[model samples]
Target: MSGGEGGEEESLEFTPTWVVAAVCFFIIAISFAVERCIHYGGKLLKKKHQRPLFEALQKVKEELMLLGFISLMLTVLQGTLSKMCISEKFVTNMLPCSISDKHKEESAGNNTATMEHLGGLRRLLSESALSQTAYCASKNKVPFLSIEALHHLHVFIFVLAVVHVSFSVLTVLFGGARIRQWKKWEDAIVQQINDTDPSLGHAVTPIHDHAFIKDHFGGIGVHSSILALMHSFCKQFYGAVTKADYLALRLGFIMTHCKSNPKFNFHKYMMRALEDDFKRVVGISWYLWVFVIVFLLVNVNGWHIYFYMAFIPFILLLAIGTKLEHIISELAHEVVEKHVAIEGDLVVKPSDQHFWFSRPQFALILIHFILFQNAFEIGFFFWIWVQYGFHSCILGKVKYILPRLIIGVFVQVLCSYSTLPLYAIVTQMGTNFKKSIFDEHVQAGILGWRAKVKKKHTLKGSLTKPGSSSTDGSTVRIQLGGITQKDAGEIQPVHD
Candidate 1:
């Protein structure tokens, strides 16, 4: 190439579209990381505290930051890309000519100058016009429905933000009330215990027996589970709900157990039922729906970048849902039947063991693998889109949409792959929470049974009384469940 040609090549201007793509990609990556941290933190905290509503509020704050950052990054990137040069071919071949003021002063008649300006203006209009997908792909490069879609997306997120804030306030109120109520009842129980048996009674029960309260309130799970359920219930009530059968099925499974417990308290039953509903909604419904909608929109627009944003979350939602189903079904089976240990690693009951080899568990693993593969396909598609878009943009193929499509896909795949780990981490964290309850305390049973037994033993009367004379005239320790007396007194079996 000659020096002049080299200079021309160096000086040749093109749109800075990659900047927009990069911004979007980074935003998605950061958001996924934040989301993972939030879920992991929730799991760690849920074990320590029963108030999940506070965690939900914290999640809302994180999501708000994500939305704000995404919106701002997209806006700035779009503005930068819009200012880059239109292709020279596009300017010369398609644009209308401008009417020079000098030619008009010279009365150059209806000739080349006027026609040139009109031609340049017409070509500008043509190049700027875009189909919805291409328009969105070329965002600021074109004029069309992309603006409306962008506006709508932001508007939807704003509405979501408002909803989150409202829910956060409601959660605080509900959690405060619930905590206060729990304290009140706990105090009453402690007072009763103190009045009846002065030795063992305390204001709060021992923390070591928290397993009892956990069983009563519902087992450990994501704080999002409860919030997700409340969101689903409102959605169902307002006729915006989906996955209705899944919700009902979970409810049925829980209620089946309730029917066998005639002494079940209504308040406890309702609280537990709601908690279960929340668990299902969070693991399966909320993230899954978000993934589907984002994927469908990306597909319809043919934008590779959006697919990247949608993919990992899509895979994660499926994986987490499968894990949850396995854990829940396994626990449900465990509750209904008593099983004997077969090997140290296995339990055998009348029905089959519901471990990894079981039909349901195998199916769940298969489903997770399938979702993972689908996300991989999305990454491949995004790569192809980006490669083609960059090539075409440099080659000045302004008339074709394929290049822009490729770039969008490239952005999608790049962004999705980078954040895939975070999604996996969050999904695994949620699964771990569900699994922890099973691992630590499945056969732990309710504490009230032991409490009742202790009461009965205490009422049987002291076998040794202070300063009471023993029949054998010897000091003996009086052990209730054993034959021992510490004082010099005969074993008392006084009538009640």
Candidate 2:
């Protein structure tokens, strides 16, 4: 009967209990092969100067990192599963062949009973491995994570991995596209400026020096072509080298101009605002980046899941706030411009327009909201660090996710409730956009950018003077920025 039972047990364990080890090894082998091929392939194509190959190398690195991340998750899942399904407390459960009996057997030099005990253990393991369905189908207490939870987490990780890979790939493709577009735009602008008569360009499209182009449109050949274009498309792509450049693409109400001063080139103010905000954001962003690197590398499953819960709101709010600013820039540019200023000397008129989004008060309100929101992000990691135990494998800690989220709500609400002398801060002073205030108050306090602020040069005896753009018979003296634009082109569209 025992022999028959042994045969049945052997039949039950048709597959190896710890086959995941072999799977891990196989995955490693495959990754290694792929990495080697990519690295070598890039080297081979270096002589041809195929720019795409460089990006491919970068993609390979990101892919390998993600693969390792996925592999680590799978390994953990497999190890826990194997333990729950096939392993048993063999030494403790050897009561039938008690320690005394084993000693006696050893003293008498009788090996038959000992061999039988070992054989029985093997059969037991085989039986357990084959009956793995029973473990999953019922409550499993062996692993820290319940079988249901483990599989659920595994599924989530799989989906997350897929999404992550897709995002990376899309970013690369989009980056390439953005590189092409940005280059094309630069070339067009250069051509337009070169072809444009300087006298006309000054009054309408200001023909600026190399410094102007360098300051504004990330001047041609100024940045590393390969590096700058790597992920130039998306400012949101955290690891992108050109994230600052992407951020610099927009300089909204930060480039505020007093409607009173025509000498105040919106383009010049635009450049200054761009530099200030870009620097401030880049400075502050490194902290978040460091946190991200640590967070990802640590990969604590419960903590990560908890983070995702809160981070979703953070990311969503960020995107929404950005969109709101863009809309405000378009619809209510005048109000924000008057309320926000870059110069210390220029006194702007109090923005009377109240209903729309261009209100200075609203801009400042949004700015503070964003500040608090960012502060919350920095605080979250610390909160997680303090509240939760870092024993990453303990899935029972997943229960804390919801409770902490509630606490976080309380934290946010409390923060909002506790009011400060914040009104003073939002009150747009002439010295608002200066560098000294950047880190202290306005970390990139850009609302949105103004496209084509047409400074209308209203001069003395302008309408009375006989000047017809249609006739082109006589030069018109429209005093602009102290420079006489002699032949003013067709009365250009003006910005109030």
Candidate 3:
């Protein structure tokens, strides 16, 4: 009879448990791979002078981040499911089986047999402990935040940050270093330019310099060739580098910019040059990064998928914030480059009428966008988890999921509350941009503002006038760059 019962139990379905779990893991892996290949790959290809490769990289990164995000969301959905088991605990927890006596019988005995069964529950609890522990510990003992849930979430997030940040920083550093290396190789060319030039250094784009620098040293260039040298290497079949991994890329850009600023001393440049190192040290020293690291350390006890799901919002929000800053910085650079400086000691001349985008307006838009998206997402997350848990609870197996739902609610609420300050920060950033633009354009020449100046003539018979001088002896002069305040009979070059 025992053998027959055992056979019957063996024949019962196990509910395709691994199928869902495996699919979740596979999807996550694929998502990261795609994102890394595209974003990091494009960045690399662009540096290589391979436009095709660069284009490919961008296409890939976009597709990957999108797909990965979707897949991760789906995996989160799958976590609420359970393997259909015969434990009376499920019946008691889900249905009116609490009073059904069978569950009481199951838990009543302190005998060896009952103790053996109790061990299994303990193990299950340990393995499934995710972010919903408090909920899991309640009278109902819902399986909200299981260890498995948090494990996956934590690992995915950690890897994402580490990979992307590292890749970005390394890319920047490598590009910057390579450019420097190439410069060394081009000693002869540099000398030639130096012998005949005073300002040519300002003109050579780092791209061209890279080639010449390497060519001069007889070293096989990593990115040489008019065509793609290793197209296969450029394309990731499974995994590509992520934004977290692109420290080098970021450093390279910083170094490139630092070199251009005349006001930056060697110490300043050095600090910027070693920014990654500083970030590393600070990351280690700072409590937040350390908290994350330590929180990850708890994974050594085991893994939790819920952590992965929880981390999604955090990572996405931070990435969006960083991307916003990058865009703003780019715009700022353009504004600074073409803006004309005047006597006001500012870049833009006073009385400039037209304006496109002020820094403040642009920043405000971004801040609004981020907060809006965050609000919508947090709301959606809560809605999904709550609905799923409530439905499961009605079915008598709410076990772990219900607790997770409540915890999710609390977390979401807290994050929503925090968004207010974040919104303010973004708004302030926008305001600062607006101020910058206004400052640039302040005191600009206006049609109605009459200039009063005294004109003096030198032996050469050239008229000299001070901008602030009274108009007593001086003729009313409407002046701009390349425009002469001399006789109106003389043609003055109009300024744009």
Candidate 4:
């Protein structure tokens, strides 16, 4: 308790104006560097740079929006609670018993005696929350200049994300890359499939996938990925596959792995499907990907130093777990399934099933956990909001708030983690929006990928008379005026 015991605590409630100006300049410079990196990175990779940049923008905007929006929410919440704790006389009613006398003096309008001796909002918090005060908040403070700067910054970023995501959605609705622009991609991708694996056994013809732009102006990558994941999850709960069927498939997929039926290709493809799904959901612009990852880590430091990180970790872990939860179940089942299908039918188990069998229950469980976690955090935040910090920011009360800009940004960033745009796309352009490798394996059901039968084949022709063989495995023949030569695999060839 070095705080009230008063050894070395000092109020660093403000910073010089020049430092704030420097930080703003730094942000602008960093933004310029980010743009250049994206411009060059896109050029070097031969990838559509616009899409990635747009995706990165989308991430930035959403997080900033969340940071700003949640900050606003916390501010509003704090203000309301603080007002409630203010008695009719304007003296705070949340004061502890030890400070009751001082509060009474202030309430009694003792103009000669300063009420600063009441020790701010420290007197109101529950004992458990109060114990953290001395160790973490000994020199905690609120910087007016930094808070003002952060307020403006958060607003700018929030509005930007809201506008960016909105504009991207609008463009998608209007459509970006027209028929001529995107048709080539469809043909080229399908042509690649034809060239690589002709016997893949399914209709992989390029569906009319709508492209938002020739490059990535809109959040196409992120939007498409989001739509695909949602569709996949929704399919598991109802539709053709029941919850039971979904869980059963997850259960059976793992337990059915046996020595006799080593279907390595099936297992490989199934896991690859999961990997693709993961990429589809999370694959965004590398710039955005890197930025969020870095900030998420930075948020860890913020939590260690002051306040809390809200539901960031829980939200993130759940998001990832939702994508890959089936692996553990499937792999475990396969190990057991191998023995059952091979040597031991001794232990009763669900019969082996489709490679594409899904586990919606796993998804449901995760959703429930996330919901509960969110509810608990929200409840606690509300509780603390009402119980303490009558005149200061929530951080200034419950958590340390020294060095205004750092704490302000850190808290806002923490708020940002709690906000995410799970469903970014609202415009529906039919089946073209979603493409999943996971769905390709279901060969018989309603959503299965049935094989496409080929209509034309190569015609055989009558053989020609033999010609002289050349030294290099070519055929040389004497023509009316000169010699002619053709390579071994050439249909038409070298002239002499």
Candidate 5:
């Protein structure tokens, strides 16, 4: 009877290897083709003036990343299901041996004999035939491949394909928005020039003719603005500014003018504001790169190692998010300072200090990190646990699920609450450093002298005027700061 049962189990365990292989091949081929199209299409759109095509490709890339993430999650679910099914089958086969022993004992009407028979049977099966039966039950017609191994490989390929598809999406959304915003700003500046001085309206040169706008407002405007803002803050702290600081201050003024103007697209205004700072923090850390590479290598080897490496990306992402918060806080502080300087009577309130974080863009980024990025990270590892058959036994299931649940809760809390503390630390450190420098300058008697000299120079420069300040037969002089006094006065503060 046992032999017949074993044969039936073996027959039922057959896995269609060719079908799985063909499906995997098709998936890989399709993923490769789609990825190639995204890559070359992005490049082609970039070279040409195909704004719509480029934007479409960028959107497609983001969607692909989302799809890849979903596919990986599904792979994990499938893996868990397969393991559970296999384990349940093993438990079912062991049940018959126990049932037969109970029947024999009941017929004999002896409890001790029944117990002895049960023990003997169990021992015999465990010591000899259990391995053979399990091997047979697990085996399929796929040469040396067992059903478990085949399932694992198929899930692995599916995950790989998803990952490839995700990374093929490019981050080009910000570029197109930037160009459109600049063109609008140029038009606004040209209109302002024509409105301010009607006599030279016919001779008012194009926006590109303005050297300051062309040099600073071209492509690297955000970068220039950040550097300029940082310099201005440094100058305010330390009365005597360096050449670098002065240039940065000039850039900051230009950025503020562009940002404060009502004619420009505020949504696309400061898209790349914190991008450079993010790159600076993440790129300079060589050890993080090494960790990333090592984790990838381990992930490719097998599920066991991949399980540990899975959380590394989440941790790195959280770190990046925290750094971004810090950058935003710094930006907010600088913006408030600029406002206070421009509107001399305006006071900086505690609420104004946190204004940047409340902005639509910052809020959107925060929501994405919490709702999308963190959730994806948690789902990914949850899938990993389920996929590797770690949840089969009671002990294994507890070991796999319990710690990860706790970790996930902890990670969520950290990502959400830790941003403010990190931001505070960064700001506090800068404040302390600036205070210390100011104290040193005061003690050396250089602070007061420098302030007086700057004040006197400003007064003299404002009163002085050049006679030949004309461009293209237009008497409307383009100030070195990218805006005349009247234009500056007309500029409004950005509400968002």
Candidate 6:
């Protein structure tokens, strides 16, 4: 027994000091080296691809700024509203007259001493007991709900409405700014390309082949065609253009594609525009719903049963829905792949692999379903709150519910309808903003330099007629809209 005890004590001994120190030192050195390498690599990447890095940084900054603004607004709203609801005066005003009077009377009496005596001599003779009782006799007399409480609750709802409306407005404004910026950049890039290489201008086809696109790829097809076109275009013009010009060409292609295949339906367009925004908002609202649900279940009797009733069926439905969606997605992918293969379109390949289900994708889908269900549940709870408060009003004593509900519904409808207009406004704004910035910073300087070079070249060429042939026997002709004019009288239009 003595030997076994001694062995157990030895097993429980701590690691030696040198061993622990060495391990920690190794970890620190490795971490420092990794950090330095990462920093150096990032700088190298930024130097090589300055434009892309700048754009990415700008995007991240904008997103973070938006997130920070929203968080600050929410924090202020919660703090102010909570303070108002929990104030002593507000709590006291919320209590009923009868309860207030009873509480006052109970507080005036010395009931603690009587209760202490009734506990027998053993309680009264405790050496450590205080002369005054610590318990509050009137603690239970306070009412949970009062007039002030109802008022504050209405105020909270109004604040939430205001916040939602403000968010929508901000989103619209920011989107517009981004659109304005993009448009300026596109115009500059187009002008630069036309000036430098007029022959290449013919490649910038007006994207009006909507019917052809739809027939070939179906609705909102994968970006394989665009990718293929970009690859071929870049390869053909390799080393002939600057990085900025290449970017501009790609942007032009995308814009042309979008303009040609416009979604005519307003609702569909709105849905697509707000899809990412809605997903983010819904994610936040789901977290709020979870907190509310937990609070309600803990404070109110029988609430857990209702939660179970809703949650169980929702889980079952979600499983069925996800499975159905998976099947449909697989079928669509297979059909697209088969069509592409048969057409022998070597320029583009179908993206069937991207549609395959993976662990991470499945997890994302599950989260989406949870958020969707939570939104419904939150709305249902709000309705219940309204109904309960309305029924408890007792002949218009609590008169705020109807007006609050009406205002909230009206505001909600207005915001919902404004989504499409907001999207259009935001798009336009962003395009304009992008164009202005690009012109002011990049295009203006380059255009000025090009103008001087062109002027010198024109002076040298002025000795001969504009349409005169060179030593190589090739005639000098002007090309406009993909049509070359050998002579003014022989000019003719070219059709696609």
Model 2's C-alpha root-mean-square deviation from the true structure amounts to 22.3
The global C-alpha lDDT for each of the candidates, from Candidate 1 onward, is 0.36, 0.37, 0.34, 0.32, 0.38, 0.36
- For 296-401, candidate 2 gives per-residue lDDT tens digits of 4454433444355455444443443333322222222232233332222111232314223444334434333333333444354343333222322222245554
| lDDT for each residue of candidate 6 in 408-449, tens digit (9 for 90 to 100) | 343333223322223222231111111111212343553465
Give candidate 4 regions above 4 Å deviation: 1-29, 41-393, 396-496
lDDT computed for candidate 1: 0.36
Which parts of model 2 are misplaced by more than 4 Å?
1-29, 40-159, 175-179, 182-184, 199-201, 204-496
Worst 10 residues of 1 by lDDT: 429-438
Candidate 3 deviant stretches above 4 angstroms:
1-141, 181-190, 197-496
Model 1 ranges off by over 4 Å: 1-61, 80-145, 168-172, 175-179, 198-496
Model 6, runs deviating above 4 Å? 1-144, 196-496
After aligning candidate 1 to the native by TM-score, how far in Å is the CA of 202 from where it should be?
Answer: 20
Better of 3 and 6 by lDDT: 6
Q: What is the TM-score of each predicted model, taking all chains together?
A: 0.26, 0.31, 0.22, 0.26, 0.31, 0.23
Candidate of highest TM-score:
2
Residues 66-157 of candidate 5 have per-residue lDDT tens digits of 54775666556643433332333443332212455446535764457544654543344333333444554575311132334444444543
How many pairs in model 4 have backbone atoms within 3 A of each other, for residues 3 or more apart or on separate chains, i.e. clashes? 13
Error of 1 at 72 (Å): 1.6
Residue-level lDDT of model 3, residues 416-465, one tens digit each, is 33222222222222211111111112323322333323223232234434
Estimate, for each residue in 287-403, the C-alpha lDDT of model 1 and write its tens digit. Answer: 533654554444422233432443443444334443433333334334323432211111112112433443222333333333323433433333433332233221223333344
Which residue window of length 10 is worst by lDDT in model 4? Answer: 421-430
